[model samples]
Target: MPRAAIDVISVYVRKAQKQRSRLPSFRSLAALEAVVRHGNIVWAADELGVTPGAVSKQLGSLEEELEAPLFHDGHRLRPTPVAIELAQTLGVALHLLREGWDKATHGLDTGVVTITGNASLCMHWLVPRVLAMQAAAGGRAIRVTSLHTSDTWWQSTVDIAILRHRRVPVGWESQTIGTERLTLLGSPERARRAAERGIAALGGETFLAAETRHGDLDRWLAAAGVGADTERRDSVHFYVAIEAALEDMGMVVAPIALCHDLIAQKRLAAPFPACTIRGAGLAGAYNRAICSPRTAESLFRWMKREMRRCSILPAV
Candidate 1:
């Protein structure tokens, strides 16, 4: 949670304490929280084990209790700004309550550390090295999950998160692991052709890009001093884009750490190594309340060391 959100929650708590009799029902609050969090009444109803009509009735009760309009009638229920902030605060509060209950029932140290990151990073980089990371943690079980969004941090039980962020969120600890280096990769034949023709050949070939990294191609081309417009194909994930490139569909600009093994194995080729662009810095973040300091530090060190081992070179 951010500092502003915490302040909002604190103010809400103080008000609720002052007017104890006016506090909304827990069921109504839960319905509001679920509806706002998921942005769908049907989904919230399913999660709460009820029907959409029941959820709607709960929301109406909550709105009447709060004396504020929380949603606007439209094609889809659009939450008002107040509703969004209230839902965020409620989410944090519920997560804290759950954490407290878990801590009370089970001991603090569960002997298992959960790490989460983007799907591409988890698949291409972290999953393959899970055993090594576990060994580094002194035999503690390591769990890795692929989480694509950053907004669900409070809902997750992950101990550490590897994210492409430079700033740490409030009440969490973070350290910069490394700056991701983005390189243009393709099959050997396409790479060899591009290498022979220099940077201009990039304009002639189709560029494969991920929707997650929509601007990478233009950024790389600008860094390489190439201004020509090129055909581009988009994929949902970077790993998918790289996979397409492997099938000789098109060239892809991707993080070297995710493709270095393929490059080393000659399955992929870095056509213009000198044109590599610096992508976002990778940060390892952990909430101190959930992860022990020693465990967080050990995993951070292991991540840094493993990242340092990934080197990109042109395919032989």
Candidate 2:
């Protein structure tokens, strides 16, 4: 063959090869989201009870399908911009679809929907409205799990997750309950006495922090510019710590929303002024992106409305 003709043939073959290569299947997208949320393929695999290699292959498939890498962060399993964008866009509808399909084809039940959240908050702020949601959603059961800061629901079968967050995530839609400020909560007498001298005078006060809290200390510090140092302390679970502090025993820094009723009732008091915490409060977000059941979607919407009607998102 002539040299030029041979070169043209090679170029055509390469172009053909590129088009023939493909990416992953629809199932792999689920794996990609699982890996991003959980923080590693191994953890994702463990959560899914599948092999790491299988997770990896699914991830590879997703990347191929997208024609770009989904994740490229250092946290081993965190999402890249592409992944975050994709998750934000695709998470809700997909999960809802899956759930709907499962119920339609696989004898799934729409009878009960279990939700998990911080225990006390759920009991006090969220539980009262369960019946209203059930009524609105065709008598569906809404079970509340309180005191949950992590994904304890991973071990159990759950329909939805509801909790507090500083911001509604980009991928998920949320309904605002109400807003509250953060206060350096303590025994009112102690805080008043501490205030008399100076703000930092309570530096040696006992402190309590949540296990996997979001912006607990930062919001507290930013609110009052907290520089006080505590002399003695214990690292109890967040709920326990808050409960103890509310009893007027010690000091805790928490969002006022979590302690609002008690504070108004004089059970707890603000160590600093109310305006300090900026007060842009939390709302309830349904991770519709991650769930795909029509019944669950029905339940999620019903719950959000019930929350609004019952004022569960914000205490009022």
Candidate 3:
């Protein structure tokens, strides 16, 4: 072989190796990001469109490259401090990447704000009144997706979220839509029965509950000065619980705003008038974005108005 040919091949190989060494594999980085974001291997696998084993392998490769442990091995998986920090930075970077992609695909402005939240809120509150979103957007469109509050993976999909909690997420802008006022709602007949038999009698009546809002009934009963029996009850979704109440299955502690339409239609009645649950409420939140401030602000305003109109709001 010619010495000049050998030299050329050697230079090309060196250049390629250097380029590869400078850049971390996106696959490994993505796996690590997903694991950190979700705080687990199974969920990270779901997010990355792969198996848990695949995610574990990627994490192992990443750890070997970085020479650090990212997660603690135990009964419950938890991210290491370094992993948490990396995840936070990655989330911001992903948001920026999304912004760039948005600009490329939809141009500088599209006026679309995607929202996600509890399914009950979506069905009972937003879905019925989505025209309000259209009106608020002027000519722009509002997209909504419903998910269980337990599912935090929606972060990647939604521009804003209407969480059933008051905690303002870190690194995000939040508007308190309002504190949800509690009310003991029931069928009109049941309300009449409670009114006639006296409100205290409801303490012994069958009640519907939700797994998530486990102690709400107890809290409301305590406030009402009644000792709840807590027997002869069934658990279901907030929407389903309301449906059962409408069917005269039992009484339920529901948000007044969510029950407004039913109350207006006379299908459901609040035996106990609306009352506030201290330190509890829903919030609308979005990532900080410079280009769509007006759009996000407009939606936030609309959310506040809706909450107020339905009496879900408490003094902020």
Question: What does candidate 3's lDDT look like per residue over 1-316, in tens digits?
Answer: 3454355335434655765654347787788778877777898898889999988888887666555687888777788766666556656667889889988655524756677777778877887877788677565676778877467634475677888765544666777788777778788888878868876776678888887677788888888877866554656566778778889999888888877777888888876674445425788877654225566678779878887788642221
Prediction-by-prediction clash tally: 0, 26, 0
Candidate 3: regions farther than 4 A off = 1-108, 166-171, 274-279, 289-291, 312-316
Residue 200 of model 1: what lDDT?
66
**Residue 190 displacement in candidate 1 (angstroms):** 1.8
Candidate 3 clashing pairs, residues 3+ apart or interchain: none
Instruction: Name every residue pair that clashes in candidate 1.
Output: none
lDDT of 2: 0.60
Specify the highest-TM-score model's number.
1
Q: Order the candidates by TM-score, highest first.
A: 1, 3, 2
- How far does residue 290 in candidate 2 sit from its true spot (Å)? 12
User: Candidate 3 local accuracy as lDDT?
Assistant: 0.72
Across residues 1-316, which tens digit of lDDT does each residue of candidate 1 receive? 7767676556666766766745778888899899998889999999999999999998998776665688987788899877888888889889998889888555435578899888888887888889988888777789888976545764667788898874556678999998888888899899999999998656778989987887888999999887748788887777788789989999998888877778878888888888888888899999877787777888899888778778456346
User: How high a TM-score does candidate 1 get?
Assistant: 0.63
- Lowest lDDT block of 10, candidate 2: 307-316
